[model samples]
Target: MLFFILTTIGKFLTKDEERDRELMARIKARDSSALSELYDNYNRLLFGLILSVLKKREEAEDILQEVFTKIWENAEKFDLEKGTVYTWIVTLARNKSIDRLRSKVYKEQKKQSTSLNDDDVFHPLYSNESDPLENTILSERAERVHKALNEISEKQRKVL
Candidate 1:
C-alpha cells in the first residue's frame, strides 16, 4: 500500500506537461494559488542557480524575487512547443543573475575608472551617442540577418 501510494504521488508530480499548462492558465487568469505553487516548486532551484552565477546570497535572493515577478508577468510566454517550464524558469533566473552581475561589474569599473577586463564595451562611464553612420550600418546588418534566416532550412535554422 505504501509503495503504491508513493508511486501514485511520483506519477502525479512528474506530469510536467499538465502541470505547466494548468499553472500557466491559472497564472494568466491571475490566480495567486497557481503562482505560489510555481514559486514553491522552483524557488530553491532558481535561487541555487542564481547564487552560483551571482556568488552572493542577498543578490541571488533579490534576483530570485525579480525572476518570479517576471515569470508571473510573462507566464503567457511559456510555450511547451518551444521548451519545458524548468528550462524557461532556469533561463529566466540565469539571465537575471547575469544582468545583475554585469551591473555590479559595470559599477565597480565606473568607480575605479577601469575597464571590465580587456573589453571596455560595457564601460558605463562612457557614452555611445547616436550616429547616423552607425545606425545605417546596423540597419544593413539587421536586414542581412533577416535575409540569411529566411534562406536557411528549418533544421539548419533551429541549429543556428
Candidate 2:
C-alpha cells in the first residue's frame, strides 16, 4: 500500500503532460500564473547555465531575473513549434548573460581612460571646447546613441 501510494503521487507530480501544456498555453495568453510556473520550473536551470558562463553568483542571479522578465513580457512570441520551452528559456538566459558580460567589460574599460594626448583627434577644435573634432564626433555619436536608446522601453533596455 505504501509503495503504491508513493508511486501514484510521484506520477501525478511528473507525468501530467496536459498540465504542462496548459501552463504554457496560459503563458502564451499572458497569464501571470503561467509566468510563475515557468519561473518555478525553469529558473534554476537557467540560472545554473548563466552562472556557468558568468562565474559570478550575484551577476547570474541578476541576469536570471532580467531574462525571466523578458520571458514574461515576450511569452506571446514563444512558439513551441520551433523548440521546447526549456530550449527557449535557456537560450534567453545564455544570450542575456553574454550581454551582461560584455556590458561589464565595456564599463570597466570606460572608467580607465588611456592614451590621452594633447594632439588627440578628439581634442576640441575650439579652445573653449573640451575635446577635439574627433572627440566631438565621438561625443555626438554617443549622444545620438543615448537618444536612440531613450526611445526604447525601460524593460527592453535593462538587458541591453
lDDT (Cα, tens digit) per residue for candidate 1, span 1-160: 3223323433354467578678878998899899999888878767766786678899999999999899889988887655446556766876787788788887878999975673553443223665332343355457777788999999998998
Give the whole-model CA lDDT for all candidates, comma-separated: 0.70, 0.65
Q: What is the TM-score of each candidate against the true structure?
A: 0.64, 0.57
What tens-digit string does per-residue lDDT give for candidate 2 at 1-160? 3223322433344365456667778977879888898788767666766786678999999999999889878887877555445545656876787677666655655677654443432122224534232343355457777887999999978979
Pick out the ten consecutive residues of candidate 2 with the lowest summed lDDT.
117-126
The per-residue C-alpha lDDT of model 1 at residue 23 equals: 84
Among these predictions, the greatest lDDT belongs to 1
**lDDT over C-alpha atoms for residue 83 of model 2:** 43
Position 126, candidate 1: lDDT: 27
